[model samples]
Target: MTAALHGLLTGLTLIIAIGSQNVFVLRQGLRREHVLAVVLVCLASDVVLISAGASGLGALLRAAPQVVAAARWAGVAFLLGYAVLAARRALRGDGGGMEADARGTRTGRGAAVLTALALTWLNPHVYLDTVLLLGSVAASHGEQARLFALGAIGGSALWFTALGFGARRLGTFLRRPRAWRILDGAVAVTMLLVAGMLAAG
Candidate 1:
């Protein structure tokens, strides 16, 4: 029971941080576009990563200094690039392009699924949280590792479901272009802050 609670708390702490993916998810949730697919992808990715961590890969990651260093630099570069793009959009005050293009109507579902997958899988922080941090914590539980993993996965599902579905309440308010601009600016600042944290660590 204690392990389960610990896992739940750890998962919540790691997942609650703001990042590009969260920004994308929030935007999609507000738009009410492909929300189910987005939630599933996010939750599934978390499950896979947390499971891998529980299986002892977390210890392996911790021992590998070079790999962690490489991931840090790569993550830094990605965040920096994302921040610049967001800043550019903010400066242009162009929130109009945030919507899906009309030309790809037929493939919208597939595209949304793939975008969610890529967003979850391609982000290095996901691995850091699930495969390393959560993994290491679960490893200490010994016989309780499986229970801890379950709790972590449950926490992730709960968070994404609430975040994606609950965001719909803001849909009416987010319809304004000014709202988009503000969101984009917020995203830009978040990206830069995350990058600074990663680089500093």
Candidate 2:
């Protein structure tokens, strides 16, 4: 495969994993809440990160061990906090059932946007996947690395669009409070596990 196609396939494969960002997007999509904004934020972040990676930012990051250390600690804290919130939501019987209540909405737009930002930016795996790994792979292409980055960007856009839009198809099964509780519980477990891995590494 060509470098661009390689990047596209690699990017899709990596991002398709059930990570924190995917879980957040899936929840927002199921709720039909700020889906567009969340998708845009995630897509934009992938663009910037992939571009930076292709441009040798990965080497820069390696040179600055302190930056990675700081980011690691911050990511651990943020992810653990998110895990707690998800656990609480599961326990409280909330975070599912997107149907309108007396108040018209359960989560506000600003909250959704903020959550999207945190999930995308604060996740250490994002940097590892988009920056170090993708960047290193692109470097093998010599001058075609830019094309590789573009391909990665395309994959990111396509995946997020599909994920955000395609998630609503599961609304029937996810309409119940019990379903929501299970989803949130899974999310909480994922967050905790990822955070623990980050801390240990």
Candidate 3:
């Protein structure tokens, strides 16, 4: 029970951050575009990562200082690039007026799923949080490690479901291009800040 509670708390702490992926998922949810697929992708990715962390991969990762260093730098670069793209969109101040490309619209499910996977895998912080932090914590529990992992997985599932479905209401407010621009701006700033922190650490 204690392990489960700890896992739940850890999952919540890691997943609650405002990142590019979260923003993207929320926007997609609001647009009602491939919502189910997106949610599944997010949840599945979380499960995989959290499971790996609980299974001792986190310790392996922490053991490799070089890999962690590389990942940190790579993550910083990715975040900066993403922030630039988001900032560009914000500056353009265009939103709902812009329709998705034919390819994106037609392959929305595949795109969203792939994007979610990539976002989960590519972010170095995910490793730090899931593999290092969560894994290390769970490991201390000895036999309860598995239970803690299950609890973390449950937390992830619950969060994604709530965020994806709750974002549907955002459609009402984000219908206007102006609202979308504001959201983009906010996302851009948040990403930049996260990137900065990651790099500094």
Clash pairs detected, candidate 2: none
Candidate 1 residue-wise lDDT, 1-201, digit = tens: 888888888888888773667876776777677888888988988988899999988778778867767767776787777678768766776653334344232226676677677556656677788898888889889999988998888888888898889998887777656776777788789878877887887
Q: lDDT for model 3, please.
A: 0.76
Off by over 4 Å in 2: 100-105
Worst 10 residues of 2 by lDDT: 96-105
Q: How much is the lDDT of residue 81 in candidate 3?
A: 78
Tell me the whole-model lDDT of each prediction, alpha carbons only: 0.77, 0.86, 0.76
| lDDT tens digits, residue span 121-142, model 3 | 6677788887788888888889
How many clashes (backbone atoms < 3 Å, residues ≥3 apart in a chain or on different chains) does model 3 have? 0
In TM-score terms, candidate 1 sits at 0.81
Q: In model 3, which range of ten residues has the least summed lDDT?
A: 97-106
Instruction: Flag regions of model 3 displaced more than 4 Å.
Output: 97-107
Per-prediction TM-score: 0.81, 0.93, 0.85
Error of 1 at 106 (Å): 13
